[model samples]
Target: MNWYVVYTKPKWEKKVAERLNQIGIECYCPVITQIKQWSDRKKKIEGPLFNSYVFVQLLDMDRNAVFQVAGVIRYLFWLGKPAIVKDEEIAIIKKGLSDSNVSDVSVTAFQVGDRIKLESGVFSSQNAIVQEISNTHYILVLESLGCVLKIKYK
Candidate 1:
């Protein structure tokens, strides 16, 4: 078993993960907890850590079992190929799951106008100015500290 990055269609991370799990293939779709505020109440919800990718473990399974999953785009790769993930790291992750509050760890879509706050590390106070956006994390300009901090959009 390994952590192979699975490409999925838009808004289909959960669907793909579910389908893969149904086939006896283990999958890890990391998610983050979010709090939504309404008129008078705040509710917490879980969302994907990565917007369009999820991890899965495959064995001698036929391609039909994989390609048939709903919303599956393909395995992430270069030169138009399916890239395989190694097993050691996957074991590390599984170990962490044994005793941690592991959230769905996926890529985050950091966009403009998204308000953010410092959660930890050096500049854990001053507001984070979203200077740039990327696939995995957001590049923030910490004005108070006079340095740029690239924080994972967790």
Candidate 2:
């Protein structure tokens, strides 16, 4: 089994997942929790990590079977070759998602002395040491400042 990208029809992401499940195609669609505001109050819900594409694992021979699923527009490919996601990367992502022995609030772990770089933000392309880590922020000691900087970067 290998990972392949599936293109869903307009506004049919969930429908495609259901159809694929019915036909026994293994798929992965990670969702993040979000809060929705209504007139009176707000409610929490899960939303797709990606808007229109989902990953599926299936045998190479099941090409036609995949295209038959409702709401599946097509398999993304290049030069007649199916787009493939590496199994190792998929395993890492799944393990991170399914860690039961963890805190209620997800906290990304960072090494205190590990060298790291950031891109696209106020500190774009800056290297720093992770001095401390919070649930939603990184307390990094910038190379230039030599003092700790509390950055709310994901």
**Top candidate by TM-score:** 2
**What residue pairs clash in candidate 1, if any at all?**
30-104, 30-105, 31-103, 31-104, 31-105, 49-106, 49-107, 50-106, 50-107
C-alpha local distance difference test of each model: 0.72, 0.75
Model 2, C-alpha of 62: deviation from truth (Å): 1.3
Model 2 misplacement above 4 A: 78-80, 99-154
On residues 75-117, what C-alpha lDDT tens digit does candidate 2 reach at each position?
8774468889899878876786667663233435467776788
Model 2's TM-score against the true structure: 0.58
Candidate that would win on lDDT: 2
